[model samples]
Target chain A: MDLLPQLTQYAFSGLSTGAIYALIGLGFAIIYNSTGIINFAQGEFVMLGGVLTHFFLMVLKFPLVVSMAVAILVATAIGVAFERLTIRPLKRPTPLSMVIITIGGSIFIRGVAMLIWGKDTHSLPPFSGNEPLVIAGATVMPQHLWIFGLTLLVIAANKYFFYYTISGKAMRACSYNRTAASLVGIDVRRMVFLSFAISSAMGAMAGIIIAPLTMTAYDVGVMLGLKGFCAAIIGGMSSGFGTVLGGLLLGLLESLGAGLISSGYKDAIAFIILLLILFIRPQGLFSKAQTERV
Target chain B: MKRFVFSCSLFVLILTCSALCGASQPIKIGALFSVTGPPSFLGEPERNAAQMVADSINKSGGIKGRQVQLISYDTGGDATKAVQLANRLIKDDKVVAIIGPSTTGETMAVMPVVEKAGVPLISCAAGRKITEPVNRWVFKTAQNDNLAVAKIYEYLQKKKLNRVALLTVSDGFGSSGREQLKAQAATHGISVLYDETYGPKDTDMTAQLTKIRGTQAQALICWGTNPGPAVVARNAKQLGLKMPLFMSHGVSSKKFIELAGDAAEGVMLPSGKVIVADVLPDSDPQKKWLMAFVKEYQKLHKVEGDHFGGHAWDAMMLLKGALEKGDDLPATIAANLEKSRAFHGIGGSFTYTPVDHAGLAKDAFVLVEVKNRDWVLVK
Candidate 1:
């Protein structure tokens, strides 16, 4: 393995992980854009997707595709319920309070997950198989391809949802001005509900695709969630390609940094990049600086 | 005045009687385990094994006609909590000896407290530092990371695989194993080609493994607990790396095999003899004891006895041996444990001494490879 091959392998692996980060970051962006609250429990939805799929497939003996679909649906259901129970019921909602609530919800869901699934790490079989596909002396598992393909599919779906669909446009309206959107009969509350459902479903799908490679557990959400949040921040909380790019960049930097610099500082490199981005480009690299009128 | 003097004499007599009765009371042994946290796989089995041993001992007419009482606390794998719990066990519970704190970090944190309190602590964690420098009051049942390193090196020596890549977790267990791997490389006629680390919560190690693939190393040794090393094994397999992948004793459990699935095939690790007890010849001293413990643990806990539980079983039985021979005093138990010689129990035949508290040697571990998702003793 020469330097080029090694670097190529690193980039390939990084892109796979970056795709996951992008998916998770999109979840954070969706909720943030609509509700103005960071869904800290967004990561839990990812965990729930993987674990629930494992449960459905391994425990309940459901087929793989059925398990995946049900897992995503369950996670989306929970997301909608979360919006209804926590976000919508806030008599006096503040950004800090809502964020704290999401954090609390994340911990609660993790605890319940532990009790139900267990603390042991569980792995799902790869969707196709575990065969290696080589390209230019770099090898990747079939699951990596699944990650790339599904990430692109979800990003496309997300674009279509937010741009072409009426509900998505209404959701965008809610993001801009919930009061005005509601005044115009857009049903701001329903738009908020749709955003949670979409983001959580997307997040669950991300978790399912990656579970084969990374494995899943009740507490896996913490780090993945934090990393996804970082992705969202790097993308300046964009709901589309910006977040995807942010995720890819993060994954590539993490993988490359671990390979070239030192594996010991792999996570450190990620956090350092995050800090730099926050310092230099407060509004993120892609998103335009906004001027809001009161 | 005569009646008052008589009553005082009677009170003295009663106090002496109560003190004499206290001698027949059950011996209290304290245990600290991370029985419900991330390391619960280690701590849960240990706690269960200790309880099982205590119960069986009591069933067999007690330890020298006095019942044994095991007082266990869940440390939650936290070092600070372990120290606080250790203090409670020593000061409030007044146990004769302590069995665990499950993990190395917790055991190390609780070591100074036990030393100050003069309670003998037989830890279940495997970090060499737990028993290094020969702390008089601190001992461990898990084989030293140095011994595991030696076992791997010995195998490498036989296979003529000198150059190796080291990937260790940046935590207490991995760092300790990494240090030993580096320090003992020369002795075993091996050289390290690449040394890398990953966080405990890291999801992937393809980048690290890919770099190792680029190196001139003939073999790879990953030191970490479940999930992390499992991920490494999968990544290596994905890259089609033909080099033999070695793992430290940290992941010597069936859980690792299950987690890694097919990727676990061909992965080798140094493990306590407990996991391979049935395959051991009857001539082996620890076989009978190991078999009996496995059966008893399964019956009691409904789970197979792995290396971690075997550590607790060893700790509890070693303490029992000391208690049966000596009186119920911390000093007596410590002295008795120090005198332990060729005690054939699970985790190997432990021979404790005044100087060497870890007791087990390199032979405490046997190199085993995963074949068809089962541990096969490596020839």
Candidate 2:
């Protein structure tokens, strides 16, 4: 194997994994921007997506597309219910308190999922086929293409929603200044609710697309959620294209490091880069530093 | 207040009466299994099988007309938790003997606790270190990992595949297997071209496999539990790596086939004969026992029996035999276990001496392959 093809293989696999992180990072960024709180339960939504789709397809014998849609919809519903049940009831919710609540919700959801689905991992069939396409001595799965294309489409739609739609504009306003946004007659609570809905749906979609390659289980969310959080931190939680770039960079570094260095240090490479970015560029690689944080 | 005092006195009197009258107390035994965490696949079946054995013993009128009482705890695959639970079982439960602490790491963690307490433990984990140094109180039923590696290497040698790549998980089972693979490579006339490790929770192994693809290795041997090895299989297929793939006994179950999907096809491994019990000839001494256990376990759990459950069955049955032959005291049971010879069990026939705690030989393992999503004994 020549160095070039090997590098190409690394980059190709990295980009697909990066796309998953980007999806999850985008979810974290959305909820953070809207409610000024990091929802740790964001990962559970991703787990729900894959597990529910698996249940629908394998157990219920539903078609792939219908199973995916129902899974995403149910996850979004759970997101909304989570907000109504856990988040909206707080009388004086501090940022730390809300973060802790999300962590609790994450554990609760994970436990319930474990009870419903056994500890064994479940795999989803690849959307296209199992055959790999070779380009310039590098092999790529059809699922990777699906991941790349879907991630791009998602980012573009997210951009349109946040910039062009009125509700999305109002959510941004809440992120900027909640009191001011409420004073201007925008229903801030609705924006917060909407943010949860959008993020959970996005997270589930990401889980579904990546399930074929990574295999899905109840506990996979912990590592993946932390990695997405790293991506969000690296991208400065921009809720835009910044997080996408952050994920791509993290994935590539991890792959190349594993290939060139020792595979044992693969996970360490991600954390090292995360710590370096936090120390050097806390605002993230792609986001502009904000003058004030709400 | 007067009525409450009278009732308390009455309760104490009844307790004393029952204690005095109950001469034939049940024999208490403790078990520790990782029933719910990452390694639950190994632990769940093991727990079920152990419980099944205990129930059957009690049903048939337990050791010396004393009913057997099994107290099982779930360690969740955590070594620290295993140690804590071991203390609770020994000090609080007052169990004469202990079984399990499912994985090698947990088994190793609890070994000192059992040794200090003078309790005999028959672990289900396959790591060689569990019984290698021959702790006074510890024995295991699973075949040593060196035997599994030797079985694999012999097959590889027969195929003339001299050079191989190794990918292992960096946990107890894997690190132990990696050590055995490295140690026994020379005598088997095989050389390792590349060696790499991935975390137990890692989702991808393409990077590691890609590095192996660059090597002159003719085959890749992966040693790890489910999901990790499954990912390696998928990654190898995605990379179109045209080399034979071999796996450790950690993945001798159907769950591995389901997790890896199509990638599991043509994957070969070394496994306990319990996995291929149905195909074994009648002349095989262990075949009848294996078939009976497979049927009984499936009837109870409604699932196919694998090597993991077989390990627990061996441990419990070994303990039962000792209890039936000797006094119910831990010391006597330990002595009885040591005196055992040519005792047939699921993993293999055991012949425990004072020197060798893990009594099975290299022939305990048979080479098996995954074909069409089922295990086929390689001829």
Candidate 3:
């Protein structure tokens, strides 16, 4: 009944939702870093993950874990196809053209998804049962723990991959200086494709994982993607840690605002506060010591 | 020139002869429903219901031996398209009356067009604004939101649950219901202790629920369509917020139950009698009509007669009853429809007065509880 318990509940819920946004923000970050093009279809990949899993689980009668894995793979394949079919073979493509193409790609994906799944909302069974774990009167769902555990694990894996692995080094090098990396005999094109593949899988996994907590529908991607992009912008787009912070900040602000102020003005108040916070460090909440300005 | 004049005179004579014979023109009804969009779930069944009713009417030799023709256009949940369709139905088809435009947004959009054209429009949307101004030619079959609020408040008063928390979606349906909920609560001797809202597309509602849990409220009322309300149900369950949860009729569908799964158990909402048609007592006036509708609709679509379809059935029946009582002229039909009181149809028993174009009574809603993923009548 105390203020502490209510605050804890809001903060915990916010962080859990923020973790999903962080995964989506990372998807944006990876695609942006490698190609300098915002893959507007990031949210659609998440939708595809959730919807395809539902299709596999309910219609095809596949086991849940297998269906989830297959869903992730399918989304990843679509990412490869998207990059290869739309942007790869372009000759002297303009920046405006690339932007339009990605936007068009997102719409196309949504249209196709509608035909396949209709406009109905779907959900996945929770990894654990529905009961929440209560701590000193605060509550958290089992799915939240799943999200936090998996997101932290993925972030750690990504950090290790980028710092130590040859492919990750090549990806980082490509982002740093594309032409120079290409001159040094790195397959810059391959790195770009790899980034798309990885980010697409991540987005889809986030969709599948968060869907148990949140209902998934054909048209949910647009709002989710827009919020994730906001998180990416507020967290330095270049830093993984900053992206997580940005996602957490956005989620917490929204939750706290909705709880304390008028729920109707939740988004408005949060965005105003976001604008104020960004006024201090326009670069973002966190900035890498040395960053090439895009 | 002489031959041309003779041909014209012959055509005029034949037209006059057919007009005298009384089998010349079929009674045309224009229907606009969102058959393929986000609100398509509402429109598809409505379209089916209208077509089924017209077919049966024509098979029974229609009113005064004239065939009944149903002309429907899918609005696809777009307000612009609904307006365009309303114009076409009025100016082109020359229908005596019009039914539907499915959702609240579309019905509100087409109201001006139908009112200006002087055709009786029976809208299937739940927004109170649809008929609040009492457009002379406009009426609605769907129960007004205030009635649903009344239904909930009536239950609250009976249970002596005086204080409640309110969570509404920040959309048209939710906002209107929010106003009505607040306005109607005081009359029922209830106080809204906490009022909250969430985005229509918001994925989490726990924080708001957590705040409501801290309030001295006896129950929570969530006003939203599917997905958001479903998430709230799950969130409330996970947070162990055991206070009774009441949802708006916006989520009166199997979709919400499916989305919420086990979490939907014990959730209550005020819904049309269509969902519990089979369970109604034989002594009830609407049971026979509701069952007939259920049989006919299921025979055609293989699905149970739902709330949306029930709205269409009521409109069609109202128009038929009106046409039988009055002439086919638009004004006469409008007058007849207004005179229609204590009329039994699937949605509810409608009683229209000059001031109230929103025709259904508070009895239109039945308090239903979710049990094992199906609606069970509570009262």
Highest DockQ against the true fold, candidate: 2
lDDT of 2 by residue, B122-148 (tens): 998877788879998999998888889
Give the clash count for each candidate: 0, 0, 0
lDDT of 3 by residue, B240-346 (tens): 88799999988888888989999999999999887788888888788989899988888889877788898998999999999999679988999999998888888
In terms of docking quality, model 1 is medium
With a 3 Å backbone cut-off (N, CA, C), the pairs that clash in candidate 1 are none
RMSD of 2: 2.3
Q: What's the iRMSD of model 1?
A: 1.2
Q: lDDT: which is higher, 2 or 3?
A: 2
Model 2: docking quality category:
medium
Model 1, residue A23: distance off in Å is 1.2
Q: For candidate 3, what is the DockQ-based docking class? A: medium
lDDT of 1 at A108: 91
Better of 2 and 3 by TM-score: 2
Candidate models: Cα lDDT each: 0.89, 0.90, 0.87
Cα lDDT tens digits, model 1, B18-71, are 878776788899999999987898899999899999898889989889899899
* Model 2: DockQ vs. true structure: 0.77
Q: Per-residue lDDT of A162-215 in model 3, one digit per residue for the tens?
A: 778998888888878889999999998899899989989999998999888886
